[model samples]
Target: MSLKYLKIMEEIKLGLATGSLIAGGKLPSVRRLSQHFSCSKNTVIKAYSELEKEHLIYSVPKSGYYVVAEFQHRTNENEVIDFLSAGPDKNVMPYLEFQHCINQAIEHYKEELFTYSDQQGSYSLRVQLVKHLQNLQVFTQAERLVVVSGSQQALHLLVSMPFPNGKNNILIEQPTYFGFIESLTLHQATAFGIELSMKGIDLDRLEYIFRNNDIKFFYIIPRFHNPLGHCYTNFEKKKIVELAEKYDVYIVEDDFLGDLDPDAKSDPLFSFNPSGRVIYIKSFSKIFLPGLRIAAVVLPSLMNSNFLRYKFSSDFNSSALSQGALEIYLKSGMFTSHLKKIKEVYHTKMQTLVEACDSLLPAHTHFSKPTSGFYLSISLPEHVTAKQIVHMLNEQHIYVDDASRFFLPEYKRDTLLRLSISQVNTNTIKRGIEQLAQCITLIDDRNDDRKNHPIPNNLFLL
Candidate 1:
């Protein structure tokens, strides 16, 4: 191959690495890219054609070329660690026990698993969930439970379910879970966001949203919320339950990380509202494996008919095989045992991350110590942008969720970054933190320079 061809191939590789061409992402047309790069169409064609032949890219007749899959290459320890992306700490996952349970479920329940299970989910899993919720002090019955594929699906179904037309508004925390926002958007529901604080949802803002809008439902993650690892206090939970009662608004409490708490004794919002006004949704993915895609929503007795209808319409049911396996896993006492192990692992990882941040990060940068769950949000200086920080981290092969993405368009705050400890090991955690510190310091330095040497009017013209 000529040097020109080699350079084109290098550019393709770099594009994939930098996510200029993401997985399942379509590449620009050869002619378009050729013109942009000021290169011949044949050169662009040669590179793409070569990649296609190698099965790295695939093309459709009318559609364009797309990256099919990532090619894994062997590398050293640091390179391997870099490849592992500085996101959640995967080392804490209970892979062995989970795999064992899955294998056993498949082997023993092959025939039953192949068929469609109940729309409400496997009876046994529902029973298990009832027990799990009771253990968490949120009392509920099996009849009140419905299983969805994941928390995302649960949110989708909840948002889509018909409510009184006049009371169609939904209340969500500003900068809350992105999936919840997407769900509300898809359902075409009007959602008003309540501002959040370190103490959890701002009660004043909650009341304001409720009083100002005809909110039929309120969605909240009262325990270790995504983007912000703020857990609701027992007092706050009681106050929230009171507000819901006062307004006659159903609170959709996403207790996605309820089981993963290190304390294991924190009270959920649902515990306060036993009258079925509060719908509690929980996920098994973060604590277990993401592929499990198992989530349960505890519905009020009155909503049972609506929920059943919704579940029937939405994919008919959750995965029967996975539900069956989870049921067996729960019955065998393996689930709890594995959870206990994960708690210890995650607790230790959280501590390590906190320690690393304390030592490496600037004192001005602040973060809350997460009591449970896989993530915590770090607050940067006011002038710093989360997007810029994420970009800097990505250049070093580290990935993090920008906190701005979690907020509504009107609530764009640039000073926070959500760091997840679910996909990295202890060693990688240390390294990732060091790199993050470096990135932040670099940004701070640049800001200082800009402040000291303001841009001239002539530069603005360019």
Candidate 2:
């Protein structure tokens, strides 16, 4: 609609909000309103019709339109106990620190903030990232780094951009980040999933796929992998870099949660060869505020120009104000201190989940404990399905992600639950876990196979 029609709606809304229009109060007739506003009568009719549909007003055939009663069409929802989200908790955000950084950024670069920034990103932020990457075992200068809106954007660019390899096949881990796996199909790209072992993906299988197919790249979350929460060992990282070099393929390493815990044992895939083959992407929104909208991708020297060109065309550049604030925040030395503080909180929450799972979950259930990050993978009995468990859990007001989604449809029957205590408070972990255990027991009790998997009801409480 035109601005004039929009203005009419805004005036009516204002009248309602300011108490000038009471419930059931009559509104001006279409003919009278049109004359008063100097518009067509049809325009007034259209406005009234739209407002009627919105439940803000109602029309009587002869009396004309009248305002409706206060609109409320929602029920009070029950509080949810979440074990699914991997995003940072909002209640404990360092709002003051960020506000200070934003204020400082506006004051220091008042003029620059309004102008268009470099296509790649703010150079000052990229330079600061060089020092930051050093601590993460990656050493790259600003020229090799391109700031992206987030890891999702980097993943899209990598997936869609032309690869020198003859084939468009990409390799990923089975039961990987389902969100990424789902979107890969959008490009009509062929993808192969390598089964993840205790340490990492099977080296023998990875090499076999590389030798057989003209693979473009191997997308991986080597650090704090989602669903599995498994970090590749330094030995595995070296072998991965070596295999990529041998097969002439690229490795897109998503170190989104690397900063959450600086476990020295698991070096990044890029650390093996900074300039060789690894494409490293770091997500700042994970550790910092979610709206930071700043993630840097350190491209292989040969691929730097290609990625920069693609990013330039896609978004022109990421939010410079966010980049500027982050740069100031880092320079203030608060980023490190904030990391230290949240590391402790996340560690404590993780421990609580582990202890609860150990005591409450069934004897046949198996899981892996993560050193850092907010994920744990639980393998349930073959008799149960992740979807069934998720449905039952939801009924109890507990939320978790079904690991079935992380795998391809053919492998979806695999019964696993990817639980993360990232959103739930620490004190609620035991209760939620205990409730889940009861639901599992109830399922067993309803089945004829209850005798085979006998778990005392009191055992979980003990």
Candidate 3:
């Protein structure tokens, strides 16, 4: 399908954003827009019609279209600078395009959607996934891929299931994805932690842990790690996989944000050991539609049956409708186009965030400098806690995450803060950092004051 109309829609949206097109302002006539864009009148009409459907604009009986008056109110900002939300940017989400896909899917698979589906997910969707995985350097066939509700479900299942290695414990990075930590807690599984920083983990420590710990599998987010946004180098990934093989330990590679990696030369851990020492999990939640709850996991063929049994107990199958719609979206090449657009958008946003941090943060503060990812972490000064910063920022309607929950109990620290670039307005990033720097300085000063002037022990008695 031609995306010329989408371009037209984007131009109008940009106008609205920049105040060039005010609420209730009359829009250019169909003929004028067609002449300006050098497109057909029907194309202009279609663009306007779509905007009208979205309630961004309306048409009179005989007059030109006008922006919806209430649109101004919706777009008006109350000065909320959000760094907590980790979802895709609301402005760029292809909701309308996917809505079309949903309609097409219902018409194509109306009979199959409501009934029970294959416990391993739809075969047709898996085929499309096979093709999609190739883009991420994960070479696998549909036979080895299992579609799940999401990557979280896959991680939860792996945490509880018995691995082929027969080892009982799980090993993870010290500060990892919180959802996975929650799974470990609920299952009461024995887990070991390896410290990770922007520089990556210590290979010697990892080898020692792998050899000593009765580790079943190492759960790793190889790209754009949650909270830390730390991505491993190709050499590190290859070594990790080799060590896992040498130790008879399995590797669960969660490449959730791999699609957004700017390094085309970088390969997933699965690519290093395609014969199945590594299990690859890809999540669509970060870069694509999250509400669909769709993810694909490439498992070792030997473990597929056992994994399916566990999946069967969780839910009969993932949403068949979601699978069907995603298949069409992939087959139609919409997903590829969407990826191209978002890749640049996120890369630019991440750069902006890092630049702001470098210029605005205090000298005592340290932060990760990821090339392109949704998160950038800040290490606060000693005696300055993430809770203090989070609470202070909340008063100003600025939001950020406390990274304490991301750590295992034994490795917990209170001075780490995570700032997500996904949902924050790109224009407001510098301002948010400015406020955050002030908060950190205030708390650091208070700590200094307390040390210099201690209250006397007898003051309370008096």
Error of 3 at 170 (Å): 0.7
Superpose all Cα atoms of candidate 3 onto the true structure and report the RMSD in Å to 1 decimal: 2.7
Cα TM-score per model: 0.78, 0.78, 0.92
Q: What C-alpha lDDT values do all the predictions have?
A: 0.77, 0.80, 0.91
Error of 3 at 296 (Å): 0.3
Please report the TM-score between candidate 3 and the true structure. 0.92
Residue-level lDDT tens digits of model 2 in 35-139: 888888778887787667657789998789988866221112444678978778643456655777999999998978767788788889999998898888899
User: Candidate 1, which ten residues in sequence have the lowest lDDT sum?
Assistant: 72-81
Residues 60-139, candidate 3: write the lDDT tens digits.
98999999875442323456788999999766788778888999999999989879999898999999999999988889
lDDT of 3: 0.91
* True lDDT of residue 29, candidate 3: 94
TM-score: model 2 vs. ground truth? 0.78
> Which of 2 and 3 is the better model by TM-score?
3
* Candidate 1: residue 153 lDDT (0-100): 88
Candidate 1: lDDT of 430? 71
Clashing pairs in 1: 88-422, 88-423, 88-424, 89-421, 89-422, 89-423, 89-424, 90-422, 90-423, 90-424
